[model samples]
Target: MNIDQAISARHSTREYTTQAVDEEVIVRLIGAATLAPSAMNLQPWRFTVIRDQALLDRISREAKACLLETLAPGAQSERFHALLDDEHFQIFYHAPVLILISAEAPGQSVVEDCALAAQNLMLSACAEGLGTCWIGFAQRYLNTPQGKQALNLPQTWVPVAPIIVGHPKTEPAPVAHQAPQIRWIG
Candidate 1:
């Protein structure tokens, strides 16, 4: 698919098929992510691809535990609860590939760079006939000691977000646009 088609078709895929994405496909996805613009051209992002089911389950459990502890018993907590109970939440609908995006600290623009890279990866995945979902809830638990050890992430690197990748089971609905809230000054 072309860039426009990819952008138009791209959406947050919550459900995916169980097929494993090929290693070559993952390489292409990362290549696309690397093309994202960064502050000072400093590519300050690293990705850890998780394919082991045991590790994925552990990460999910740790993340849910941390969420339960940190968030109040309200809407946020309810959402966490639902995520914990979701069959596809941690496993990405049993997709064999989970890419964890991380950034090294001591830099001011790391997070922004990582976000840009993530957007690129998602769009590229859609173009490649793959589905992806950006997961932000994993960061909280990933910062903890147990969570850190579970993923074997370096101390300098912090988990920023995760993307679940696989063949999409269903097509995403198009998003509606809202009125522009911009002011132009000449």
Candidate 2:
């Protein structure tokens, strides 16, 4: 698929099949990620792929706990509170793979640079007939000391995106989007 087609097709995939993505396909996607523009061409992002279901489950549990602790009472609302409190709510949505886009070192625009890479990765996945979702709920926990230890990553590596990828159970229907509110000054 072309870039425009991929852009339109890509959405946050929540349900996935049991099949895992091939290593070569993942490598190709990461290649696309590396090609993303960076500040001063400093590609400070690092790729960490996790395929372990047990690990993902543990991370989901811990992350939910962390988020629950940090959120002010009534900040998350009742519905969200129930969801986060549910033990069966997998934050990664049981996807077979998680490609973590992390920053190996600090930079003036490392987070922004990594985010661009993440977008590239997700779009590439869409082109490859795979579904992906950036799991924001997994990001904060993966940056914690315990989370770093679980991944055997240094404290300095900041986890920016917790993107899960896998074969989607069924193609997701497109959701309505609002037009951009533009204000041009020229």
Highest TM-score model number: 2
Best by lDDT: 2
Q: Kindly list the per-residue Cα lDDT of model 2 for residues 1-186, writing each as its tens digit.
A: 998999999999999999979999999999999999999998999999999999989889999998877766674556667889998899999999999999997778999999999999999999999999999888778889998888888889989988999999999989899999999999
Candidate 2: residue 23 Cα off by (Å) = 0.5
**C-alpha lDDT of candidate 1 relative to the true structure:** 0.81
Q: Which residue window of length 10 is worst by lDDT in model 1?
A: 86-95
Query: Model 1: which residue pairs collide?
Result: none
Q: What is the C-alpha lDDT of each candidate?
A: 0.81, 0.92
- Model 2 residue runs over 4 Å out of place are 75-77
Estimate the Cα RMSD of every predicted model relative to the unseen true structure: 2.1, 1.1
Error of 1 at 16 (Å): 1.2
**Which regions of candidate 1 fall more than 4 Å away from where they truly are?**
82-91
